[model samples]
Target: MSLHEILFIVFSTVVLLFSLMTVLSRRILRSATYLLLVLVATAGIYLWLQYEFMAAVQVALYAGGIVVIIVFSILLTHHIHHRSKPFPPVRVITGLGVAGLGAALTIWAILQHDFHYHEAEPLEVNAKVIGQHLVNTGDGGYALPFEVISVLLLAVLVGAIVVAKKDKANEQTSENK
Candidate 1:
């Protein structure tokens, strides 16, 4: 009935649709693009909820940064247009069963829970506070996790380089043969 409700419905629908498309798309690039749409729609929901700072971070880190990295990775692998193989019938049926179970559990949980919604005054976003929490050594600190993720990304890049070199080497050897 209200504008906020209408926007929430729209954004949520966009997110769900794009998320489904992202998972189902055969082309790697199309899947990545769909994922980007899902992330942007999620950011819109954050904005609608008046979490402007969170929305900005979602757009910047997820929609902008991660999606760009994914797209570039696909391009670098020369698999931007690669079509994924279809799942076997048994695998597809199993996957559908698991997904249905999860959905049913989620719906049951939502129906059982009583959520209290309170409209609070919007607080100012403090960058300093956010930065401190990100690096804090105390409880709920994300410093270690952030470092771990950086290491993981570095490892992935190194692996990609190694694979690419091997492929080139194989090609050269075959040509020589």
Candidate 2:
């Protein structure tokens, strides 16, 4: 097999393994870490596919920035280590059944389509072209999304800090009393 094919296989395997671990892990922190691994592996796949810009965005935004923020927020909470165990099995089984059915439907749809089975167009890798298309989308300028994303992240940061501080304040007041 070619080097690209080998790397692709490895990336896919790692992504799948970590994704499963993310779902199956009992510890919240461990599950978040596994989720980080999955995101990083997905970025690797984007890199292997020669989407350098997309790969960098995946690493910077999802893997590095977003995951760190989420993990830290959980860590910063009041004794997340003592979080109650996950809920009972009825809802869990229902959710899993829905997920399995969705996956099967998605697979069936893919089988019915001519998706990637034939190469109709060549993929390009130029920042200039992408930037132009992003702005030309009229309604969805890429720059607009970037600003929106920043605002959303900022909101998450502020919300997490407020929650952490509230618990700290409550603890102090109770201790004083």
Model 1 gets an lDDT of: 0.83
What are the runs in model 1 whose C-alpha is more than 4 Å off?
Answer: 121-177
What TM-score number comes out for model 1?
0.77
Question: What is candidate 2's lDDT per residue for 1-177, written digit by digit as tens?
Answer: 999899999999999899988887777778889999999999999999777878888888888887888778777774657545786899899989999999999999989997465555875849887778677636535777677778978987887788778888899999999
Compose the digit string of candidate 1's lDDT tens values, residues 35-126: 99999999999999877867887887778867777776677667666799998999989989999999999999999999999988854559
Residue pairs of candidate 1 with colliding backbone atoms:
none
User: Which clashing pairs does model 2 show?
Assistant: none
Off by over 4 Å in 2: 78-80, 116-141, 169-177
Taken over the whole model, the C-alpha lDDT of each candidate is 0.83, 0.82
Error of 1 at 79 (Å): 1.7
Write down the TM-score of every candidate: 0.77, 0.77
